[model samples]
Target chain A: MKILVGIKRVVDYNVRVRVLPDGSGVDIDGVKMSINPFDEIALEEALRIKEAGKAAEVIVISCGTDECQQQLRTALAMGADRAIQVKTGSALQPLSTAQALLRVIEREQPGLVILGKQAIDDDNSQTGQMLAALWNRPQATFASKLVFEGEKLTVTREVDAGLETIEVDLPAVVTVDLRLNEPRFVKLPDIMKAKRKPLDVIPLEELGASLASNLDITRYAAPPLRQKGIRVENAAQLVQELKNRGLL
Target chain B: MSKILIVAEHDGHTLNLSTAKCVSCAKAIGGDIDIAVLGQGHDAVGAQAAALAGVSRVLMISAAHLAHPLAANWAPEVLQLAANYTHVIGPSTTMGKDLMPRVAALVGVNQFSDVMEVLSPLSFRRPIYAGNAIIDVKAAEGQKIVMTVRTASWPATGSGGNAVVEQRTAQGTAAGHSRYLALNSAGSERPDLQGASKVVSGGRALGSAEGFALIYRLADKLGAGVGASRAAVDAGYVPSDMQVGQTGKIIAPDLYLAFGISGAIQHITGIKDSRTIVAVNKDAEAPIFEIADIGLVGDLFTVIPEIEALLG
Candidate 1:
């Protein structure tokens, strides 16, 4: 069994994103880029699965410009055996990205496919399920815990209500959530070795995935800022202020 | 005018409030709104959904496989009904986040997520970058639209109407190797955190699980919902469901009170939609004060008890 995981290059979660002045998109020219945090968790889980000898290999894949390979190398440094990049020039939406992944799944036929629940940059939270739907496979999303049992997997999912546990067969999609496991730090030697690892680049068109989008992101703007409030001396003053506003 | 179909969220018994909120969002678009309630023996849930105002009809789709809201089993049911409506919508809760995208993929359309504002039936404003930036999304004409309504942005539609309920059986059995296990719901007596109008949240400053009880006491006294920062939940002080943040539950309450929470950007995104935010932290430099409608630089231990005494 081989584990396939997604590695997306996104604006680091720590950066305070700034919208472009032209209402086109965010300004990412000089921004620090890194692996989507949830994808890092997915890669960490895939690595653990391979290390346990339950899986024969771990393959990390990404789609986008040439820059995406940088993040794939980072995944390789973190212990992915190989990397694949779906080279595409246009910014891919969830629909196109899922379609591209389906093309890959048909060719690779990995037993388990893992991806981040969402990318912080888009915050869409749609790609994994979309991929599963297109691939006609069961999806276990927002998984906090994964237990392998022969052909079936028992996954603990973090939901709005609480923790929900479910079971799914192999040849499925699992989108990891936070609290899965801490990602390992890449060693200097591993970074040097990752350069020699097999990194395959496939054009989006060669895979027969369309790059069209029916939904257009027309404009971008900053969110309204919250006005700062005044300070109070103690709890007494706070209570009085709340009473004045009729909030208490 | 748009014809909208909302996939209802329920747990066998009561309907999740998110369904009603989706009704509110659909009303903004001025549509012939219908709800699809999928569960076995969920007549009660159907009746509850029928009670929401502005709902034209309720589609009761019952099957043994759909008793649990697994996306794989439920997506096909929604797809069967997809061709009848221009828009297929659901709440942006975990269930909808997991289910709607699959429906979109089956429909071959990109989902419009977290629709904060409706420009037209075809165009919407949604948040990206964890609410730091907003983008206007427009769907092409003649294309089916799949969307997840951000419930926090819209108030629940008032219930008084009597919409007609139409019953139907599930189309196909998709018991394809996936099985439902158990749901450890945070069966707390506290008001449902996402639906509550008043929220009281604490942070890592509460050193132990016992220290976190102060938040519960205050919440109970004020009849508010209790929440915690990721720091508190990660520290094992509270359940993860109690976490309020971009990753957790994004909430909009009438009033929000924070105790000792430093307010990371992720946490702020969850509560920034709140009507009135008040923060109390002993450290004067806590970032929570930046967005708070009222700020108090004081010890939460002292101020909490003091406020409780004053309330009494």
Candidate 2:
């Protein structure tokens, strides 16, 4: 069985993102970029599945500008057997990205697919489910725990209500949540080895998937700022303040 | 003119408050709003939906497999009803996030998630970068729109107008590939975190799981819900469900209390909408103080017990 993992490059999670003054998008000028934290977790899970002998091959796929190949190489360093880059400069929305991934899924014919439940940048949480729908396969999302049994996969999801367990057949899509696993640190030796790994760059247009973006981002703005209040001397003052505000 | 269908989130007994919030979002979009209640033996939930102020009608869908709100079964059903409506909306809850994208894909439309403001029938404003920035977006014309409303951003519609309820069955069958096994939820008597008017959250400073007992005690005394920063949850002090951050539950409570939390931007995004925030951290320069309405520069170990005693 083969596992395909989707990785995305985004502004580092620690950076304070600022909207461009002209209301275009976030300013990423000179800022550090890293593989989306969740995507790393997904890739880590794929590596684990491969290490357990449940998967024969682990392939990492990323869609972005040529710059994204850096993140792909990092995935390869982390232990993905190979890397594929869908070259496109435009920001692909979840649906369009799913379509491109669907094309890859068809060509690769992987037994399982794994992706982050949502990207930290867009926070859409859509691609995995959309890909499953496009592929007409079962989807287990927000997976915190996964177990394989014969041809069936059991996934425990962390949902709004609580944890819900579900069973899905093979050839399914699983989107990982934060608690899934701690991604391993890429070693210096592995980084050198990753450079030798085969990386195939395919133009996004060559995939023959419709890349139309249905949602148009019109403008960007900062959220309303919360005004800071005065510091209290002690618990007595804190209680008094709450009582004065009728919050107690 | 647009016709909207809202997929109501409900347990078997009653509708979740998020459904009413979605109704508010739908009403703002200027549409003939109808709600589809899909569950087994949930007629009471349908009744609640009909009583929502702006709902014009309620479509009741009862299927044995839908009793637990599985996405594989619900998506196809939503896609079936979506053909008659121009927009299909659901709350950005666990069920909505799980189900709506599949419906959007099957219907060949892109999903707009966590819609905060309905700019027009076709445009919306949503938070990106974990609420660090907001993006205004417009859906392409001539395509049916599928979106999930950020329940925290919209107020629940009041009950007044009476909408007619109609029972309808979906033509699609449940996908046998996925099956529900069990749910392990923390049972609580206090208000749910998302809907809570007041919340008491702890951070990594709490140190250990046993330390969360103080947080619960404080929350119980205040009649508030309990929450935790991702740091606390990651440290094994609480379950993932208790995590309060951008990736966790986004809450807008009337009063928020933080103990030993050095506010990270991700955690701040979740609580920025809070009416009044109070922080107790020995480190006076903790980022939480920047947004806190009342900051107490003291050790939580001492401050929390003192406040609890004072309140008692």
- TM-score of every candidate's chain A: 0.98, 0.97
DockQ of each: 0.85, 0.85
- Candidate 1 achieves a global lDDT of 0.93
Candidate that scores best on lDDT: 1
User: Model 2 clash pairs?
Assistant: none
Candidate 1 runs further than 4 Å off: none
What tens-digit string does per-residue lDDT give for candidate 1 at B240-291? 9999999999999999999989999999999999999999999888889899
- How badly does each model clash, as a count of residue pairs? 0, 0
- Candidate 2 Cα outliers beyond 4 Å, as residue runs: none
Considering chain A alone, what is the TM-score of candidate 1?
A: 0.98
